[model samples]
Target chain A: MKLTNSMEGVTIVETEDIKAKKPVVLCGLPDIGLIGIIAVSHIIKELNMKEVGYVDSDIFPLIVVFHHGEPTYPVRVYQKDNLLAIFAETALSPESVHPLSKVIVGWAKEKNSSLLVSLGGIGVPNRIDIDTPRVYGASNSASLRESIKKYEIPVMEEGFLVGPYALMAKLSMHSDLPNLLLMAESYPQYPDPGAAAAVISALNKFVPVNVDTKSLIQKSEEIRLNARELMRKTSENMQKMGKSQEYELPLMYV
Target chain B: MPAQKRMPIEPADTWSYGVMWDHISGCLEPLTEFHDKETELMIRIDMPCVKRKADVEVNLTEDTVAIEAKMNRVVQYEKWGTFQREAKFFRYSKMFTLPAKIDPDHSKARFKDGILELHLPKKERRYSVKVE
Candidate 1:
């Protein structure tokens, strides 16, 4: 197999279902990588789609393949007459995300992705603990915005996301693909399945995926407690070395 | 330097992790409840984030009680950003080693008004029953 330094205009990962029909792209990074992963994975599992392949990368942001395993990116596709592409990635350092722009743009073009949606989380202090997370929506095209607006979700007022997901949103706009980003009130610094579930609820309108929402809601405490313990260990380790992993937490505006 | 000056600018213990968690331990509210029959063990989870009871997950086994929630947070916004990039989520996970044996097969769980309640049926207490 030949390799490329970056996301190529054509896919190096061959499709086993090439002759089946048009494809809907849905992706996720998993609940651990970022908050968005849980959302995208929820859609994928709820939709009962097949595990195709992954865009492998051993870089700072890991992207491994899946056969019968969990997805890492909260970005995926639910196929129908209209294809929906979910753009979800762990919100990490900006420099580490530059490659995302290159790869996703190429992937979108090569895959002919028509509609793209990037789901993000905006951390808020007050949202540290709650049941029903709130979400806001935005789009690359006005019509796409209208589509999401039909659900009465709040528009992503005035803010920015800087990473592969954001890059894809920007690239999709210029690439002729109608793109959008649905952001939620997330503890950007923490693994927020609640936020992810909320965003997924808002998104179920377009792609039509069915998620029970019960499991995600029920497991919230377990998720929080585990996260707390992890943080305690990390904080202790950081202190012992007189250093910190600043990149471990999410950056929320609220 | 005086004792006051000797304090570190940021205490590591004060931080949950180097990343710091969103839900504060102090903010954690107490969750306790009572049940009627000997069959149900009233379970009250402190979830200020969840709005609807339908979003909670509860599972019971012969000797275990597993519950999960993606609780919602009361949201507010402020516009001060120190970084312009990605986010890290401190996911919540708590595994409670139950103190009693529970009926893993037959159990009732409900989420009402943001609170998740589980009625874990105690085994036939074979001793708690009588016949005429």
Candidate 2:
């Protein structure tokens, strides 16, 4: 935990306890709202990256220098305009997407990321809010689409995206850096183990991990039941409308 | 006494009995206003995990607008008090009051990326004739 005189309250986050590897994948999202935060944490644990020093937000240009052991690949930290940006061969944890996706994508392109995939979720109505969640995928890059298509993950045909997902799409387009977004339907505004399980499934196809999803399934009911009351209000808000439901493959458990 | 700013209309307590517990609450920051010659309203919502457009649902009324967006389920690591789904969201639901009557059939909505935008057109106003 290091503070810098560069800027005011910007705290840079990196990790230790990792396996050095290349072609690293990084994730971010809209805000502390989506489960990207959790995805990143799992990525950190799955990949096991050594923690470098903190990069103060005040620093110009995204530069992540480890005060300790040198990282496998160079990581940079700074801001892209007002958004907080970080670039590393290593990915961050908790995968929380923030408004800074625009910033981070730029950093990824600079590092010439072979591929960048941002994982996130959406809350739905008219469903059981089950433990086994399904996932969908989208890509601004054709290669990404081709690789992910074998999994039979649905492609995003339409819709609006904001914050990190939106920015990541835009930056990748501008830089010609291929980016894909894998989203799973989750409980609105509450933690969802089911959605996380779906992400882990998709990531496993690419990131290569040894973690077991069986453990996460147990947390499904725990998290789903945990938010029953608040979900009731959301239910009331949704009842005014009527429509059919959508489905994804099982990611968590029955 | 100092005057404090007033917040927009709060979500009604007894919302439709539907299973609304899926969505978190007011996460996507809404826009300041949506206006056309016929109608105008303010909307801002956050749907963190939506990968494609087919995952959301929207409905509108003369005085109300209800939205249901499916959040991609991602577990957040730490308890940050407000967020749960991977810290992005569980779901997002918000209702709005229209300044004028709206034609639900004539309105339009678009969700690109993860944000959902709704365009509601106002119903024509009828002048009341007073007989003296």
Candidate 3:
């Protein structure tokens, strides 16, 4: 049962019939520290999610990632229970981000998703000195803000967010769909598994996933080593997106 | 879009899989960054899997910095991601050319959380001259 979804010039090809009931859509695109990607990847592996769909666009890079013995799309969709995650194995070009975000939000709206969450990292200069990275939250809706407050997650007070998650937040503002961003303090250049683990722990408080973060912490070194190339590529994209603006203070007086 | 033109291909030696691990040396290149500050130039290198500070070595000069560290154990990946090859890495090695010359003698280094931070004082110091 293959279903094709085309919107804003980006198509999502679902290979299997998805029977999720108001699924919570999660996005884990490549960004600083590869935090979101690592966290979402761990959840997918722990839950043994099945790859049911994939995304394609002309503006995307011309490449395919080989996992095990099969070649798969660089950007793919995986599902487990009511959890649907969109994971990116390769870096997204700056030009493709707008269309991709629009399509994802539109698809979420079409699915009548209960909530949409975007996991990412906030680059902190003193990450080396910090033992455990802190997770911060931002949302486009007031109810989601209350949920974040109830979870005791710090609200992102004043700063510019630049990347895929930033675009998602902006586009979801017009729609009734709530968009939540969980960003952990992370190293700007290197892949920070500690930061990923921190965000995962924070996300578990509200999301349905009950993932054990012990293995993630124990295998931090291995994850960092294996993700070096991806991290390097993500860093290049971050530079192009002016990711350093995240550290700058916003000029909002009110 | 206009008809795409066929571009000339580069040599095969330059067509790398973009992997961090070097097959010949069995060493991975650690991610590193350099910050050129006013008084000192700081270089931070991320070298995970390196357990003890004794196993890490750093060589600093006025214009360059070299680092090598041994992992706690040999890391083996039978089919690592896209680069389908069985390989083992024992250490992490990397070197960088500095953007500005520094006083190596006054440089200081510290290792924490598997990250090595080197602070090299710039040789040319700025004096606060009164504007007349």
Model 3 lDDT per residue over A62-170, tens place: 8987766688898989999899999998888888888898888888887788888999998888999888999999998898899899999999878899988998898
lDDT of 2 at A237: 28
Docking class of 1: incorrect
Q: Give iRMSD, candidate 2.
A: 10.4
Candidate order, DockQ descending: 3, 2, 1
Evaluated at residue B67, the lDDT of candidate 3 is: 84
Q: Write the per-residue lDDT of candidate 2 for residues B99-124, one digit (tens) a residue.
A: 66777887787664344656666677
| CAPRI tier of model 2 | incorrect
* Top DockQ hit: 3
Off by over 4 Å in 3: A1-4, B1-12, B17-19, B80-83
Question: Any runs in candidate 1 off by more than 4 Å, and if so which?
Answer: A1-12, A18-22, A29-33, A58-93, A225-254, B1-132
TM-score of chain B of each: 0.52, 0.57, 0.84
> Which one is best on lDDT?
3
lDDT of 1 by residue, A110-161 (tens): 6665555666665554452455677878787888778767888887655545
Q: What DockQ number belongs to candidate 3?
A: 0.71
